[model samples]
Target: MRKRLSAQIAARRKQQVPADLKGMDASLMAMLDAQIGDLEQRIKGVIEQEAASAAKARLLLSIPGIGPVSAAMLIAEMPELGRMTSGEAAAMTGLAPIPHDSGAMRGKRAIAGGRRALRHVLFQAALAAASHNPVLKPVAQALKIHGKPHKLVIVAIARRLVTIANAILKTGIPWQPQPDS
Candidate 1:
């Protein structure tokens, strides 16, 4: 909605319009920005509150790619994080690849059927990890080097992120990037 409004404002500016009308659009954009800011602050406050209640959230945030939003989402949406296996965690997030095969025929493995919102948030976090997290960056690079498609690489990273999150939660340890051995 914010993006759409910004685009509309830009478009309006490009067109020949009355000054008053342009000003109205600018005013609306400012209002939208303020609303967005307010919502972000509220989200931050809620996340902070939740983190206080669940120490696991603080542990989750210690991961490079996992921010307050991702930590809060995981704590709220996936209460089974610490108790689940890595594969189970990935499956829960819809990052696990599903196998498809028949006698004398092998079909492609694809990911499906899990928490969609959690999957989306994991993907976003994966993208950040791929670029910014030292420990996970090589995983993304290796997948790309092996000719994996962009989305496939992202899903793989998301799966890894879920596994890492699970491990940290289970162990009650903050993330410490280890050198590849």
Candidate 2:
């Protein structure tokens, strides 16, 4: 029992530090800080690469939430959006739930296809849109009413956002989220 008690004490000591800053030694912290700086520079490079890829994507920056990298990833990955209908584009990104029907029975809504990375970037944009754009927050709130999972509702909005973004890119016009009327 004493041995177990000592082990527990040592474990608690380790857990006292926050996970993000668990280690000792100033030199280790310095090295981590330098690496973080380098990573920031690399992220900057990726953002620039995205900006240079398409003027349409660059226009996405006009929207509050989308940055160069997110816009670029959307543009590069969602090429069909430029050619397909808004709904089709959204479905392709796996934002729309696949309807499963049966005789007098129905399963819950589920997002199929692991276009998860695209979904994540778009969701970020949606979050920004909901917070800043006068139009989207109400829509998000309305969607929240059905007792749907918060993430699914966000995913739905994110899909709608991509549809809106597609039009902006194709028409060479600035994005304007639909005003809540």
Candidate 3:
């Protein structure tokens, strides 16, 4: 919606529209942004209001790339986070790779099922982690160095992120980089 509004504003400008008409999209975009900010704040407040959720949110936020929004989404969408195993957590978010195989033929793997919105949020988190996370950074780089496609790399990172989140929540431990082996 924001991108479409931006495009509309650009198109209107290109067409040399009247000043008032030109301002409509910009005003609407500003309104949208403000509303989004308000909603995010409300989400944060709700998460903090609950003891269990606040703890989970804190653990999630401890991860390098998970911000308040991502933590809220995970807590809300996947309440089973701490109880599930790494593979279960990944599968719950649709970040797990599903194998496609046939008699004597192995097809490519792909992710499917699980919470769609959560999967998208996790992907965004993984993208950030791929860039800024100490542990995940090397894993992402190695995949790229090995010729993995960008989306594939991000999916793999997302899967790992879920696994890490699960372990952290289960053990009630905040994320900490492990020593190099």
Candidate 4:
């Protein structure tokens, strides 16, 4: 909405816009920015006050691409992280590919039927990991070389991320990136 409003304000400025309209756009943008900042601060305070959440967030932040928001979301939404298998973790995040095959015909696999919100958040994190994570960058590049769609590559990375999260939490150790053999 802020971006939209800014675009609208720019467009209006190009035309003959009144001073009042410009002021309104500026005020709205300011309010939106303030509200976003306030919410982020509140979230930080709440996370810090909760011992378990703080621990989880710290563990998650040890990973290359996982940030505070993603860590918080994972802690809040998926409490079963450490207890699950990699496949289970992937399925929980809706990153596991589901196969639909009829008799005598193999069907293409696609992901579906899991926590939608977590899936979206994981995808966002995966996008960052694909570009920046040394551990994940090669995996992403391999998929790209094979002609996988951008979305598919990200989903694969998201699945790997959930698996790694599970391992880290279960072992109570921060991620230590391994050099490629």
Candidate 5:
């Protein structure tokens, strides 16, 4: 779009402009193009930073629903997971559903809080984890059997991941996803 606009402006410049003014316009166009190039470089730098995040994500990937992006987001955004309880961090990730209860009639469980982006990645990872990670399969299967919605089961796994990640971060250990006997 910028290229097209630049070309259009150049076209107008050629049609209605003195020779002196044309030189000035060309300079301005060069400056604008330089700025645009700089902006593109900055954007690349920001995207590269995701690698640092992805590194942490690698650890989480071992457990269940947590790939590089999700892991990176959690590490970059929630690096303090080490300070929180497994469950607390899990709840913070919004993996745990909110309990909606009032008087005689109790309300159904619903998800309320969490890092939605990280949650998304976690669940995406969970789908893959459920198939390969022996430990996550049964839990996923059970949730499926109970008619816990597919998304919910993934969220449940995500919650469990927070717990595990927290523990690992705090303990300086990797996750040990054991097989279900």
Candidate 6:
């Protein structure tokens, strides 16, 4: 609803709209902003209410590209994170590239199924990781250098992010930078 309203506001700006329409849009935007803030606060409160969840949240937050929202999403949406293998984690989030093949016919690999909402959250995290994560930044850059499409690069980064998150959770360790090679 907020995104739709934002689009409506943008479209309104392109026209000579009435003053009342402008005022309505402003009011709706303000209301939506307040609700979003409240929701975020509620999510934080829920995470902190459980000792185990709080610990998991801390571990997730230690990752460079994952912020509070992403951590919350992971904790809430993907409860099986720590118990699974890295490939299983990626597959659960729909970041795993599935193969398409048959008798004498091979096709491109694509990701499918799993928790769609969690996948979007991971994609957003991957976008941040591509820019800021010490380990992932070089991988993203190298993919770009090789002329991979932007979506492909981001998907790759997202897969890696889930794998790292899974490993960290499984081991109960905060993310630590690798030593210089």
Give the number of the best model, judged by TM-score. 6
lDDT digits (tens) for residues 1-181 of candidate 1: 4336556657766777676787777787688778766765776677667644358877898998987768767987898999989999988888889989999899999999989988988888999999999988998999999999999999998998889999999999889989678
Residue pairs of candidate 4 with colliding backbone atoms = none
Runs with alpha carbons beyond 4 Å of true place in candidate 4: 1-20
lDDT of 6 at 162: 93
Tens-place lDDT digits, model 5, residues 26-132: 78767777766665465445645786444455556566556555555677568777788877887777877788887887898887777776676677777877776
Question: Higher lDDT: candidate 1 or 2?
Answer: 1
- Ten residues in sequence with the least summed lDDT for candidate 2: 1-10
| Alpha-carbon local distance difference test for all models | 0.84, 0.68, 0.87, 0.85, 0.69, 0.90
Clashing pairs for model 5 are 53-72, 57-71, 65-125, 65-126
Superior candidate under TM-score, 4 versus 6: 6
Sort all candidates by TM-score, best to worst. Answer: 6, 3, 4, 1, 2, 5
| Candidate 5 backbone clash number | 4
Q: After superposing candidate 2, which stretches have Cα over 4 Å from the reference?
A: 1-52, 145-148, 177-181
TM-score of each: 0.81, 0.68, 0.87, 0.87, 0.63, 0.90
- Order of candidate numbers by lDDT, starting with the best: 6, 3, 4, 1, 5, 2
**What lDDT tens digits, residue by residue, belong to model 2 across residues 34-100?**
6655654665566567644446656677766677556766766776566678877788778877878
Global Cα lDDT for candidate 6: 0.90
**Which segments of candidate 5 are over 4 A away from where they belong?**
1-58, 179-181
Off by over 4 Å in 3: 1-20
lDDT score for residue 138 of model 3: 97
Residue pairs that clash (backbone atoms under 3 angstroms), model 6: none
The lDDT of model 3 is: 0.87
